[model samples]
Target: MYGAVLADGMGLGKTFQTIASLYSLLTKGINGQPTCRKPLILCPTSLVQNWGKELKLWLGERVVPVVVDDTRADHVKKSFQEFRAFGHGGKPKVLVMSYPCFRMHKAEVYRMGLDVVMCDEAHFLKNGEAQITQAVAGLASAKRRLLMSGTPIQNDLSEFHAVFDLACPGLLGDLKAFNKTYEGPIQRGRDADATEKQVTLGLERMEQLMKLCNKFMLRRTSTVLKALLPAKVEQVMVLEALLKGIKASEPTDKVVLVSNYTEALDVLGGMCASHGWPALRLDGSCSVKQRQALVDTFNSPEHPSFVLLLSSKAGGVGLNIIGANRLVLFDPDWNPANDLQAMARVWREGQRKRVWIYRLLIAGSIEEKVLQRQLAKQGLSKALVDDVGQQVRTFSRDELRSLFRVDPTTPCDTHQAIKCSCSGSLQDLDSCKERAAAAAAAAAEGAGSGAEQQGVLGWAHLARALDSPDPTWQAVSDFVRNNFVTYIFSDHVIGETQHCL
Candidate 1:
């Protein structure tokens, strides 16, 4: 079975790419059976209709799109029967259903013997233990699997493993083996006390892992597609400066203000509404029906709404509102992908005007730190896909201190790009500590002596000991002596031994 992930940046047409892949497969028979090919696409409930619409628009008359409606139990049962006997009586070649509906009919799905399966916004399956994950994994008959997500690694490398494992199972090895081989070293390299050499080694391991997984994953950023994308002018404006500018703008100006928090949306919406620029707001609470109507109204110039206030998550993916060329990111999110997806709404394919993306930040505030973190994550993503030679740096003390040094009086320099460093969620810090404690326990158990009786020590113990009134280096040597394990993969794979540092 051939499986892969199309992790292109938001608005880069992953939907079209998957469509093209399916078309190619339909023409070029899969495993020498062209007539028996049945492909299944699973997506969020909010996107089921959109998927059907897009499939119809792109592959009209070329392939049949079998859409499952989850509203009626009888209709769902009838659809399941139809899907089980798909291709009979000249039926469609593709079956599209919302993830929720698929869950309800998982048993039927498992029996459908789908030839190919694709999951849009595959990050929903990042949790390996989730019922949906297990259900999707149960499609053992699928010959090919495709996962599409913009933010596959939202929090940690384990999340990356979870997504990649689905695309190419065992390509990253088992989760435990992956953690011991890659996660542990890469994390230790990010430790505050890590030496430059250790960091370099960790990065090299990460690069190797990325290189291995590169075969199954295709990721392209907007920068790479700059020739196709409309020119995007990104500006950084102070929050107060943004307010002043908004106040000066004409009521007819089309704008979309994006924020991570509802409070900011309320404030911006109120300000815009007060200025006679009627505003429409969409957030998590907005229904799928409401979102489509709002997007349509906002996109049409004839509509009364001039300013659309959007919460980042609700507007992130699967919804394309390309009417407004001017957008302001009123606040930043910890994940860079969210911001990227939000900004892509205006800079997409149908956009005729040059897009203006403004990021509003309070000078020297936590917002700046958040932006820095975002830049770092973006750089890391680039290194993994576009440029492996790029250096990925951990947060340094000087960098931390510089976050506070931006002059509040000076207009924030939007033109200057932040030097890219590599980082992810601080949750890894806790995971790293846990790994070290496990290593310590392993050491103590192996020693079988007074090490346990005298009081077992781990990296945390050593970290505390180093800062104590009387620092000790003895534990460091002891730790090294205890947990070290070296082994060659096999006699055939000679001269190289794998061990954790």
Candidate 2:
């Protein structure tokens, strides 16, 4: 028998619905006998503890929670080895694990013959080739399976196929046939007539597939779940003066106010080396273990308060940093969805108090234009591919002129109160003024002709300097490159000889 999937939006209680469903299953006496087969709840590691907490609150003493933290190969193997032994004997009713650990112990998970497999935030398996997706696909033999996600299609239709494939394999047929019939024509940006034909056929097929797998999947939205909760307060905190630190400066208090990810990674790497942890590159290329360790350290209270560098591509979703109450977005990303998800990590339920989110925008740069487009797009209730195309056509010329007019010398007098915007109290006005002045100075420096002379360098340059062939060049190169971006901000271009080298 297949179960339903409750894919409610963020801040809507999908967690609560999951717990209720599990409780209903647990209460039913199977064949007049108490069933001991526990459900397997697979989720991101950051949410493992959250799920455990929720389960304890709902079912209290009726369920057992086992969290798998496999730091090494042996640790992972040993955990699964025990799961197989205990699971076969009709042990606990629920086992929770992170997606990473689930993949490592997939063979054991299948061998244990779980009754129900429930995946939360299931969008992690959107990429068909990812290890976790393959592992999930292999678990189709379970008695019941449930897949859950809020925004199932963040980008395109192909992502939906991966989730559906896991829930009901043959229903969608195969990827090739599915794509040729539906996605192939639609993704081409076909004419209105062709697009309508494709959508009509696609929805018909989708309806049939839903009917076939009606017992397996269910999707719910926020509007349907609103009645279940009480009135809530939403607080918005805006820090408009923060500068995106693409340019570097000396270690001043203002510099610390908004450190770019590159600088944060450098500092974190040094700290890791000093603490005997393997030095980590906080780029997208880092291994899973490296990232987990960095996250553990950052969340630890004993560790010095420091910035964590995260690439939006890798760290935008699934990762949670519990200790961070304040967020300074160094630069805006291309996708509004990615940025919103990244910010949601700090604003989620477990947060103890009001969280402050700061978005740094370079007043007259391409960054500002990007924000403008995001705001404009958010206002539209319907899709506007044609309008977007027309805007893109005129974007370059209009954006260039706007970018040149970002004057930092002009006073930014806008002010809204923290908790109550209508309070009219001006206690924080002085602090806001100082920040505005600093932002203006930074923007003015960025707008100057000198900024163009300060050529940008890649991560490779720093990597080479750190491991230079010549010992003499090591110190010199490191010092020069370390101060390169900062020096450029000062209207002096140093290490021009190393430009080609």
Candidate 3:
């Protein structure tokens, strides 16, 4: 059994890549080994239909996959009945199913074994104690397992351990051993008040973890898609900054609103109705069959829909809504990957218009704290996947305490912390102009390495908006369309990450 990971950033085509991998194996047998004809694809319920669509679109008459949407025991058992008794012959078949559906029929799957067992958005198995994770841990020890996730580690290193351990069981040892060895030392180094020695040790262990994991993981940033797509501008604005319909100003502009909670979606839907904006929606209440219809209607120019109301959990993955060049993530997700997935819905390869993605946060609220946490997680991901700078965030005892207390002192705690001096009186605003020029020069000269390089990857674009949401906001919004945004991915700064597909 072998385990590997395809940790490409969102919209970089992990789905199509997986499909290609499957196509290659079925069409060309690996030298001495027999080709894999029976493979299982486990994904979220919402993606069950899309997976089959992708496979069929690519493979066409060469192969047909059985997608198990009906999860009743008899139906699931019947899907695998051939596996129980027949030999591998005739048409090469594939099985695509949701995670919950696989849980119910794991016994049948386990007994039948498999050639390839791949999990999409494998981070769903991040929780070690979750029943789904536990079930997947067993029964695939002999098969080749491939885990695909844009975010392998979300909150902490333990989540990485769980998913990695599943894909390549025992590669990182058991949870307790992994925590003591890698998790503890790495986290301790990120503390704000940590001694120099602690920082050095954290860097060492992080590199070691990276070295071992890189053997099987193939990770790529969204930069790969830069050649195929048009420009994308992503901004992180306090809700107060949404003074006007800035990004989606045109009556013909297509927009999408994604919320972490469905109730919030309801409020947005009602707001659309109040404005008499035509909209289509996909959520838990919507059936699987209706998902494509909703997407088609939203994507079609003739439909005349103004926006698509999407609940992140349901429509986030395996969805392409390029018809809408503008998207607003109404709220932040504790796990940055969720927000990243939702944001990638539009700024992908097929988009014709320049893209704009907005991440709205209430200043000084716990919501802003969530954005800060996202930066830290991005650091961990960057460290593990690429030889990139360390971005994992560590909070001081006082900083952690502030989570409960709202700071009325600052309009933007993030800008204040970095000591950017971008916001204040009109005089400070002028200084911000000078500092912005210097920062742009520094970035052109390659900026500082590691952590320092992150703050400057793309700064000239954000200078004005840090002060006010006047035309200043418009400047930054327009600037983002052509630049790679690191301000949002910085461990110290606050903003949206690169969300290109």
Candidate 4:
């Protein structure tokens, strides 16, 4: 019963590592029996071919895997039969399938005695009640299960419970027991107003949970790849004016502008058109063939396109737009995991240039709230996964009271809550979550450039702007100085540090 969750940082090669594991384990038998491990891989529709490719690339002729994604039912059944009756001559039998494909044909293949189940992009099962989760759960006979996700846990512990439940059934007890035990107390302890006792209890429970999970889990960050990766600088700014500033670094440089909404991408596309930047786009409207063609065109390196407009939801997961070294997350998402997944589309294994990430946010608005929630969620994730405990502040309703309340005169609500004003001076720019409320009376009016000024202090592009730097950096600086950027500041440069859980 080897169950594990390989929750490594993206570009750290979780797939390669898992393939190595599969190569080793599939060659052996369980309990001294002649039968080898029968493994089934379930992933997003986009990653089905990727899983097959990785298997071939890694295992080569040593393991021939049958990929069953044909839309035709008879064809799919034939592939399933071949995969099921696959003699253990080629190590153990392997079948690669998309989540939907597996669900559609589970009844025909569930009785095939699948011993090992690997789910890539496992976050798709974050909703415990989703039909996907139930479908994956149908493999009750799988003794060894693996859930692989670079960005696994998202907003709440409930979602964490959902994914972990699929990987290791009773590891956290049933959902109710898990909530009452670890989720309830740890969450109460993380609140801004939690008492000392509650905080201590939360720390203890978090430590206990990680200690238990570590026995069956492994996580590593991009720090391990520090020598291989070039330096990365991430900055944050605001809307349309921000879009107008982006320019390709060189003839080879490419930019990808991502937004969570297709309508938003339409607006951004219009903005790019007005600026005279050559651009291509991919969203829900595009067919699968069209989407891949666009991705290939964008990643052509010598392609004349200056920008690629991406709908975050449509193009986020399992994509490698490595031709672009710079990315702008035009807006925020309720789940930081989605944003993280989109951000990884650029700065990947093939990227040679120093990567730049820019996340846009509106001051004192729902988008700002999303950024705040991202920080809090990352904090909770760190506490759960790392050896050290962090200051936890999961999202709550009290903070949502200031949905649009703007007090331009205060410090970052994030800084004040974390009690670390040192991130940047709060005077120049302020209006994060901590100071989010004031909607009733003596407020509703204003919001910083100390944070505005200092956060970007040593950034090469803007710092050396006088000598003719990136036009985008200079424009962004001017925008911030004039108070055009209402909110700014994120965790830090991603790859240079440990970003996980």
Candidate 5:
């Protein structure tokens, strides 16, 4: 329970902060006990070398680090034994390992107790049932534990509960109690059927939980570094430009083009191939070795590759690709963290040029709704560190419909432009609540035309259904027909096929 989550946003020097704290703790034992304690760092395979490099840059010879080798079982055992042997004497030791290695040899790790256990990119264990989460949670022998992630809660509150349970176990109670106490009411409160009183109670519970969680989590965004960091200009590259296969007009700058789906990567790859652009592609299909090699090549000035085609899931975590100053989000992701992390690859510490982020999205397409969802999610996370006593904003059914109000006549370039701006303080919570209440009331009354209502509510219902734990095709179809057919798609399309749903 002594551990806390350092969830500072990307490009905010989480590694430096962590290293500084560890150096202080290991050098001067807690309460002046003069204890020589060994700590272990668990991170993604892609980040193992990065951790080693950062430790050397920050701490130098003050603390020796042993990077666990997973080439062979014997080699791993030998390295762990040597690491443990250092606990008796010599400079203090810290073991650096990838999650895969830790999962494979968790029993051995438990036997060799640790002073502190730091899990980097901790959101990887957001699935409580995952083997990695189970393994990490089983490390009860560690005296202190820290879970670090820029995005600790990715998709929902359940994921948040998983990481919070790791950092501060039993604080939120078990998963079932947490859902009953907080999640259920909050979710139901978002529905159009919920009463005003129910909504108010749900909002109160959510605020209480956020305030309680914020106490143990230290979060800061790039807003604090606005003056120090160069400008990051974001623009919308319309579907037209993307279909035509746009290229960087400048010759010196390297480009990192990302997509959430691999199909898009393949399409982009074809475009790059047609243009004879020197490029490297990475996705879930690539091995760990291949990914590291591709990253190294992309970062090397000697390489001719200027375009790096990467899938968001593969490149979103623990990557430092500052060699590239330009980024193109070929497609938007439901989880904004993926896009944010991809952008950070180029806009981080070693970057010298003014960063350019082009987010390609079609007007009135699914991407527009996704953008709205991303904004809502961003607002939720921002509320955590915002000053207390301010009203917190949460999504409602009608508000979700409003997100789909994109003008279909306009081209995406003019309609979907994303301007670069510095972060500001949260809006008055009371005003947000009033707006949401009004919108929810409007939605409940079915005030809009059948077409408008269908277009709006159809997408919102689809989003809600997708997020449900046990979504049924039949239920989803009935929802659309009952709520959207008269306003949006006519009965012809709605009743045309059962498989479409």
Candidate 6:
């Protein structure tokens, strides 16, 4: 049995490559047996149907797409068991299921005796403790395993361990040893020289492990698939602004601001609508149905709309909206991965024209800080394209002072400032000290208090809440007896309390 993962960059057709690999393996017999045993492709719920569609297009009539949803659990299990009983018989049987469904039916899946399991967007199991990871691990004991992800390791190298652990257990010793060697150092950023040394050694160990698993694994990138993709272009639009309030009051009045969506819509809507582009408004407030409908409209040629207003939270994952040459990120997300994924939405296959990515930045506020953090995370030098990827620049005291400029009128004592300079390192040290002090204070306060802490309501409480009888009517009667507050007043009180909380 062998397992492999294709960790390509986003917009690089990972799905297509996985499909191609499966197709080639199935078409050619392995060890005198057809290399298909009802391969299971596990993915996110939003992408389940999309996977089914892709399978139909790639495998044609040779494969059957089993869509597993919550309502048809028994039906799905019976069908899967039937397929397993029948066996592939020299053909492939592909079962498409979401991560949640896989968790709900891992036993059935294991009992059905699947020959191969392919996890799409495999990063969902990055957290080793997650239920999905455990379920996938249970399935990994099967004959073959395949992991597919664009970002196989994000934020920390240990994420790679989680994927490999599922695909090929015992390759990495365990989470503890792996973290001490790889994850701990990677996350320590620029300060961990000892950690970096460990990382260097760990990479070598990883390479050796890869060789041990060589018969089962393969990795590729989008650059390798360049022949299959169109040219792409990214554009950055910078907006400059200064503090609108008086200098004296600016420090106190500074607000945590985000782009006004209503105002943003007027601007983006005009640009996209002018080009006869259909607009897809995707935000946290919109329901799943609304988001999907917008995606459908955006993908339709009859609509031909280019403008898509996407919320970072909702559009960050499992969305495959494509074919718009232009992309406008109305606001910046704190996480670079989130922004990258959003940008990749337009850069996927079938996009013939150059993809133009427009990042709208509000000049001087936290937006600039957000952009700088994003660049730093990418191992780039600065926030702008010119300064990126050169050399890592350490901030001096004066430079740090300039970056986080305080209004001259704001109270500042030169004597007090002498205690700690404004260098980045000094600021970090001060932050650590402050956190320690706060923790000490909290500990002291908690120790002094004799209050008994109550645990959260459990499942029994939830069941009782659901089954309680006459409680609603009794509560209403008690409320009237206590104080004949008008229905409007009671409603207002409840609404106000909910809003305040």
Instruction: Give per-model CA RMSD.
Output: 17.3, 15.4, 5.6, 7.8, 12.7, 19.9
The candidate maximizing TM-score is 3
lDDT of 2 by residue, 1-501 (tens): 344455455545567777776666666645555443557889876566667767888877776666554447787666555555554335355777889888876887787777778788777878888889999878755646677765555555577677777766666678888788656644433222335566555445444444554455554333232244221111111222121121121111111122235665566456545644432234566655466566667666566544555655555555555555545565666545455556655545454543444555543356555554443332120011111111111123333335445544321111100111321223423433333344334435542111111111110111122232212232233444343211101011122211110
Q: Over the stretch 88-119, how does candidate 3's per-residue lDDT look in tens digits?
A: 44667788889999888787677766777889
Model 1: lDDT to the true structure:
0.65
- Which 10 consecutive positions of candidate 1 have the poorest summed lDDT? 485-494
Worst lDDT run of 10 residues, candidate 4, spans 440-449
lDDT of 6 by residue, 161-228 (tens): 88878877877679898777544543343332335565455445444544554555454433343465
Q: By lDDT, is 2 or 6 better?
A: 6
Candidate number that wins on lDDT, 3 or 6 = 3
- After superposition, candidate 5 runs with Cα above 4 Å error: 33-36, 69-71, 87-89, 185-196, 238-249, 284-293, 300-303, 385-501
lDDT of 5 by residue, 246-348 (tens): 3324566788888888888888888778877788987888766567668888988889986888888877788888778778888888887777788788877
> What range of 10 consecutive residues in model 5 has the weakest lDDT sum?
492-501
Poorest 10 consecutive residues by lDDT, candidate 2:
381-390
lDDT for position 166 in model 5: 87
By TM-score, the candidates rank as 3, 4, 5, 1, 6, 2
Taken over the whole model, the C-alpha lDDT of each candidate is 0.65, 0.48, 0.70, 0.68, 0.66, 0.52
Q: Which candidate ranks first by lDDT, i.e. highest? A: 3
Better candidate by TM-score, 4 or 5: 4
Candidate 2 steric clashes: 1
Question: What does the lDDT read for residue 476 in candidate 4?
Answer: 49
Candidate 3 root-mean-square deviation in Å = 5.6
lDDT of 4 by residue, 1-501 (tens): 368898987777888888887766776444444334678888887766667777888888788788875657998988877876746565556889888888888887688888788899898999999888998888977868889988777877888888888888889999899999999999889887888999889878887888888888888755455478654546565545545555422445678899888888888889878878899998888765466668878999678898899988778887778888878988888788888898888877877876767876554456666676676776666556533334535456577555556655553454333344334433312332222222111122211111211222212221122222224546545635456543344423222232111
Judging by lDDT, tell me the better candidate of 2 and 4: 4
Clashing residue pairs, candidate 6?
3-216, 4-217, 277-305, 277-306, 278-305
